[model samples]
Target chain A: MSSFFLFVLTTLTVLMLVYLYRVVRGPTAFDRVLGLNGISTKAIVLLVVIGTTFDRVDMFVDISTGYALLNLVGALAIAKFLEERGEERQ
Target chain B: MTFEFPLLVLLIMTAAGAIVVKDLISAVFILGSYSFALALVWALLGAVDVAFVEAVVGAGLATVFFLLTLFRMAEKDTQIRRPPVPWIAFVALPLLAILLLYGAGDLPAFGDPLSPASTHISPEYLENSVEQTRTPNTVTAVLMDYRALDTLVETIVIFTAGIACALILRRGT
Candidate 1:
């Protein structure tokens, strides 16, 4: 069971690396933001998967909850900033 | 341990990407990704509390603050200038890397049971922390009770730094 969790964790990490490639090579800032969001969403799951591996699901769940909230707030803030910038240009 | 290598690679890649990216917004986003990688590394190392702090402050708040500062700047200024490569960095970087590697050699291996930290004081704290502090988490008990003053001071330092940043970045009244 633990090994299965570890496998999932490794797979997620690999997927995150793929997203990171998008972040690095993406042509537009929006593409980079999308990649970042994907990475962050994966990280939240990674945290919970780590907790399960440690046999401390409750603790990690709390951290992941906070992480999710912050991730959403950060995405919203960036979106607002981009929107304002677009309005200024127009 | 097997997953650690890939996460560390991710960390290094994000850090390098952040530095090499020309667009300030892209760099900021890459920095946020760097923070996520670091937090994952901390979680892998079994430091969930540290990972939580890294995820919150490093990834969340710092990225937003960076974007806010970038938004305040002119579009032209947001494009980073390609500075000439510094000759000094060539000499200094290798020297610094060598010094750090030499210093690292003196430290105990990761998770060594007989390491100074694990051998001394840690056992007692691990045993009695819950009884003394009534906190289920030993790390929390140690930080909040055994070393309460230190944590308080650290909080004050962070608060002061936040104030300083706001003062420096404030616009005209």
Candidate 2:
């Protein structure tokens, strides 16, 4: 891997650590959920980057598609759960 | 090295955060993030199939299950107090980590062709998969042909889990 790409990956990872801080210390459930959603979206991009590094974009792209689909579903489910839980508390 | 090291650190941090978080809902969300990080690390290591499974199972299905269980618990129970410092865990876990790290130093370097994992049946599977199973992907061939029974059992296990979850949740409803 070139130094440029390595630098990019390092920067992105540091960005993810920032997101991790939000996840760990977010004051509200929604903030934590949004943090997780952001991280998963980044994961899809990271998968593509790793695919290019391995020179097997075709195979890894398929996996990333699946990952993205599932992440969307999981996020929606969590949002619905949170909405319902809020109503119950009221 | 650039790819795996940062990801491994993130993975461990998220896992520990998930455990330490006071709220079950926040912990579940962090756990999903942890799974996403773990999947990336697996992809970086070239284990695309395992990475795929981790993405779907860990980030997807497992998170849903955790949220469902969290909702089932009473709201009061969800607000758990901070656990006391685990003295035994602090001692045993570090000792285990050191021992594992010491052992890992003796293992072959990453992607070493002569490593036991790469040298044994894997090479033969890679060489013969296409011709023997008529499958283009060696991973597909190994899962479907070389270890069909194992795959079948895994499918059955997942099916049973779904059934069990349905049964339990149905009763509560």
Candidate 3:
């Protein structure tokens, strides 16, 4: 059962790497943001994996909740920055 | 050991691949994948609580937020090749990696009987953790009860990160 979870986790990581490649090599700034968003989602799952590893979930639950909040704020901030940049270009 | 070895190898390969990938968006996803792999390894090591946090933070919200940011970014020419950063930073990273790997050398085996972690608190917790806290999950008990102040402090730090991001974005205008 644990091994199955590990395999699933690995496959997800591989998928995330593909996304990261898009972020790093993609021509557009928007692509990178997309990749970053993918990474954050992966992080949440990663947190769950951690909680499972230690057999205690409350700490990780709080951390994951906090992480989600941070990720949302960060995305908004980046979007705002890019929008401002676009305006500046005009 | 068989299970652990393959996972570690996969982790190293993906990390290397993420660094070498030229596409920015792909790179971000690769980072996500790296985090996922890490979470798996964390779980196999018997740190279920940490694994849970990693899965939620590393695989879920972080990836979504990153994509949202990407959506608002301006398009650029693809012919520009890889993004540039200082070579010195790249050089320094390997040294850090080597140090981290070196630190792992002396550690106990995964799930081994004599691990310091297993020996450290299990006996005590087995005896008193449930009795004192009335919780079946010892890890949760420890976090919410035995060391709640620390957890609260950590939460505040996360809150501060949010505030900092808001200030940086808002004040720039």
Candidate 4:
């Protein structure tokens, strides 16, 4: 089970790298934001997987919960900022 | 341990991307990714509490604050011109990296049970934390009980900073 979790972790990290490439090379700011959001989602899952590896899911769950809430708030704040600035959706 | 290298590479890449990006918004987003990668690195190193703080402050609040600052700036100011590579950076960066690597070489291996910290007060804290503080989490007991005043002062500092920000933003608008 632990090895399986490690495998999953490797795959997620690879996917995260791909998203990071999009963030760096994307043509538009929106693409960068999308990539960041994708990375945050993956990070939350990564936290849980790490907790599983540590055999301390309960402890890490609390942190991941706080992380998810804050991630949402941050994304919403950015979206509102962009909308208010009237950035073109490209 | 297998995932650790890739995550560290991700951290380096995100940091470099943040620096190289010309758009301020892209830089801010890349910084957010950097924070997430750093938090993961902290977790991988068995520093769950530190990871939590990094996730909240670095990835969350810091990103929001950067965006707020960008929002207040003129749009034209957000697209920075690429500056010429500084000769000083070429000289200083390699020297700094070498110095840091030299320092790191003397540090104990990760999770070394016989390391100074592990051999010293850590064992005492681990053994007695639950009995004294009724907290299963030793890190929590240490932070909230053994070093309560330090934590309280940190909280107060953050609260004060929040109030100051509110005042400044209010005055601006």
User: Which predicted model would earn the best DockQ?
Assistant: 2
- The number of clashing residue pairs in each candidate reads 0, 0, 96, 0
lDDT of 3 by residue, B1-173 (tens): 24556557757866887677654455555666566567667665655567656756665556555655554565563123755788898999999999999999888875666888888887787679898999876777888888999999998998898788678656755
- Candidate 2: residue pairs that collide: none
Per-residue lDDT of B71 in model 1? 88
TM-score computed on alpha carbons, candidate 2: 0.92
Whole-model Cα lDDT of every candidate shown, in order: 0.89, 0.85, 0.67, 0.88
- lDDT (Cα, 0-100) at A52 in candidate 2: 76
Error of 4 at B10 (Å): 0.7
Choose 3 or 4, whichever is better by TM-score.
4
CA lDDT for candidate 2: 0.85
> What is every candidate's C-alpha DockQ against the true complex, given to 2 decimals?
0.79, 0.81, 0.17, 0.80
- Candidate 1 chain B worst ten-residue window by lDDT: B164-173
> For residues B1-173, what per-residue lDDT tens digits would candidate 2 score against the true structure?
46677878898999999888887878888888888888888787767788888888899989988899988789888876975888899999999999999999999997789999999999999999999999877877888899999999999999999899899988997
lDDT tens digits by residue: candidate 1, A38-85: 999999999888887888888788888988999999999999988889
Span of 10 residues, lowest total lDDT, candidate 4 chain A: A81-90
The alpha-carbon root-mean-square deviation between model 4 and the true structure, to one decimal in Å, is 2.0
TM-score of each: 0.92, 0.92, 0.56, 0.93
Model 1 pairs in collision: none
lDDT of 4 by residue, B12-112 (tens): 99999999888898898899999999988987776777888888889888888888898888888999898699899999999999999999999999789
Per-residue lDDT of B79 in model 3: 22
lDDT of 1 at A47: 87
